[model samples]
Structures are given as structure tokens and as C-alpha cells.
Target: MAAFARRKEQRLSRPDPSRKRALDARAAELVRLLNARERFCTASSCDGRVIVTDTDGTGIQKKNCTWLLVTHDPCVKDDVMTALEKATGDVVFKFEPFVLHVLCRELQDAQLLAVRSTHCLEVPLSHKGTLMVSEEYIEFLVHVANQKMEENIRRIDRFHKGLELALEAAVPADTLFPKGPEKSHSVYMHRRKRRTAQEQADPSRELEPQDDAESSLALFAEIML
Candidate 1:
């Protein structure tokens, strides 16, 4: 519909709001690829990260926590140790894998890429600046985090390839990308209206409820651990 296209354009034109104020290098290509298609646009994305944060006892409230170090690439033990020096409360080291939130033009478009799993590692490394684990254990944890980072990259690659294949099969190559903004908008609205009518006429077809921007259809591929 014209409304959805307009919203996508408005969102894309706005400034990036993530802490880094930019797309992660690892996710940049995939984001661009998806944006090129009329049926999908990325909402938010994180390629992966290794982080050290000083948190309260619960470690769940970010408002009371301080991020000491954050890196997208695999980090070494020295990096964690260096970040630990800045800790004033309980310190937690975390390895978070790639995550992407995509807004699809249709429910079926989202289903094409839907994947769900939950896996992330967080270890409480220090209690009030005092080491709670042995130096060797810290080294081992860093090694494991590094390995997870590597696996995260591979998963991203796999997801990219799979998406490419899915898009190719779902959309015609010539129409997958529009030539210009004006033409793209017109063509997209026309196709959307036609699809809407078709779905409405088909009594067996199930319709998804219209959602607000915050509840837009999303596709996610979480790390498997």
C-alpha cells in the first residue's frame, strides 16, 4: 500500500539512532541487499558483539549498568582484563551473536525468513572489582567467546545466502528492484492494491491484522549457541 511505502521511506530517511550511530560493517551488505527489494526493509540490526559491562547484582537493568568495552570482532583476554579495570560493580562479560529485525511488506514475506532461537552467553566475572574466578578460567571464557564470534559470522553468511535464494525464488529478477523512487513507489502501490483485492476475494485466505510501526512483521535468526 502507499502508506507502507511512505512509512518505509520516512524511516529510511531518518538518522540512525543506535549507540554507534551507524550500521555494523558485518551487517551493512545484507541491510543494503534487503533494502533494495520492495518487499522488505531492515528495522534494526547487530552483526555480533563481545561486551564487558558493570552491572548491579541482577544484571538485568541496563539503566544502572555501565558498558566498559564493546567490540564487534573477537576479543582477547587482554581486552577483557583492560575493561575490567574500569568496573565499579559486578562485571559481566557477554558474547551476543548476530541479530536483525526486518520489516516485510507482507506476512508471507516475513514467513519466508522467519527463524527463532535464543542463545547468548553472559558470565559474571567480578564482584565489586574483585575477581570471582581464576585467571585461567577467564582466559578460557575469552577463548570460548572468540569461538562464538567466529560462529556468529558464519551464521550471518549462511543467512545471507539463504535470503538471496529465497528472494530470487519469490520475486522476478527484473522487478525485484525498481529503477527510481517515483517508479518504485507507483509500481509498489499498484502491486499491493492488486494483492489486497485478490486476498480479499479468496475466502479461504487468512488476513493478518494491521499493526503499528512497533509491531511490524519481523524476521529474526538468533544464534543457536
Candidate 2:
């Protein structure tokens, strides 16, 4: 129990090795940039990848998912495509969004960083995304998970703009810190704007309410009838 507590303390103190563990040049550059920020510590990230897998019924039990090539950058180059051609199975490129988890010193600090980091959904884009406040740490995740290459690039560009805005924003005097881990995994899901009862009603076909006096008179007339 004592050892576990000590490990937890060490984890909360700083980012783990995964933050700096980049598989390729692009991932390495992103890790470097995130680690350079004094107010931020990366939790996890991946550059992007193109995987080749064996789908044919030639392997053991006719099931195989062999990786011919796994790269950390965009697999758009001619040579990269050539490698795919040489693959023994189906060539698949699974475009992963650039994701970064950072610990912020305070709510204001997170707000500043969030505004700078481009996010996938509007929830993270807002200040509400900051979770698990502490005396010395707060957590903010930068995510842009798009499977489409063009959309992924666009979303990442937007996130980059958000980061720039945060850097240029004025800093707050007060700082907030994390106390305990806040479980908010649901924040990663894309939030849909729900239509209110009023919004759901067809405006063009809706019947206006009769005046109270008119309604009462109508009831009386019905009784007379």
C-alpha cells in the first residue's frame, strides 16, 4: 500500500515515459514541442500510421493480421505507397488524430492552453473540459481524432490555431491545482446538440393557445349547446 501511494505521487509529479516515446520523426517533433511548454506535460500521443495486414486465408487457422509497415508520419510518399504494394495482404491506412494529454497548473492555465489547442468536439474547446482540480495540477486533453486524412489535417490545423491563441492570451494571477484524479472519460465522445421541446415543435404548423377568457367562454357555449 505504501509503495503504491509512492508510485502515485511520482506519477502525478510529472509526465511518464510515453510522453517522450515517439515512434517516428513527426511524433518526436510533436512530443518535443509539447514538453517544451513549462505549464504542460504530455501524457500520450501518436503521430499517424499506415498498416499492412494479411487478410488472406494463408496464415494459421486462416486468420492473420500481419503488420508489413507501421509508420509515424503521413503515408503519402511514393516510396511509402511502394512499400504497401509489396505487402502480402491488404494495405490499410488508419489515420489517427493527434492527441495530447497535459497537466495544467490551474483552471485559468487550462483555459489558456485549451484555447490554444485545437479540439475535436466543442466541449473540450470550451473551459468546461478542465477536470480534476488540485492544489498543483489540472488535466487538459488536446484531441483531434479524425479517420479521414483531409479532415484530420484541417482539424489539427484548427487545434494549432487554438494553441497559438492560448499562448497570446493574458495570464491569470490565481492558479488552481489538482487534488485527485477526476474520471471524465465521457468527455472524449462527440456531443450532439439536443433539440429543446420548443425547437422540436414545428413552428409553421403549431397552433397558438387560445386566450384564457376565450377558452372559458367556449366551454360555457358548449355546455349551452
- Residue-pair clashes per candidate: 0, 11
Across 48-75, the per-residue lDDT of candidate 1 in tens digits comes to 9999889876747486899998999988
lDDT of each: 0.75, 0.38
Candidate 1 error regions (>4 Å): 172-225
Against the true structure, whose lDDT is highest? 1
**Where does the lowest 10-residue lDDT sum fall in candidate 1?**
211-220
Residue pairs with colliding backbones in model 1 are none
Error of 1 at 217 (Å): 16
Highest TM-score scorer: 1
lDDT of 2: 0.38
> Which residues of candidate 2, in runs, are more than 4 Å off?
1-24, 27-30, 53-66, 73-93, 111-147, 154-157, 175-225
RMSD of each: 9.4, 21.0
**TM-score of each model, in listed order:** 0.74, 0.38
**Model 1 residue 19 lDDT score:** 98
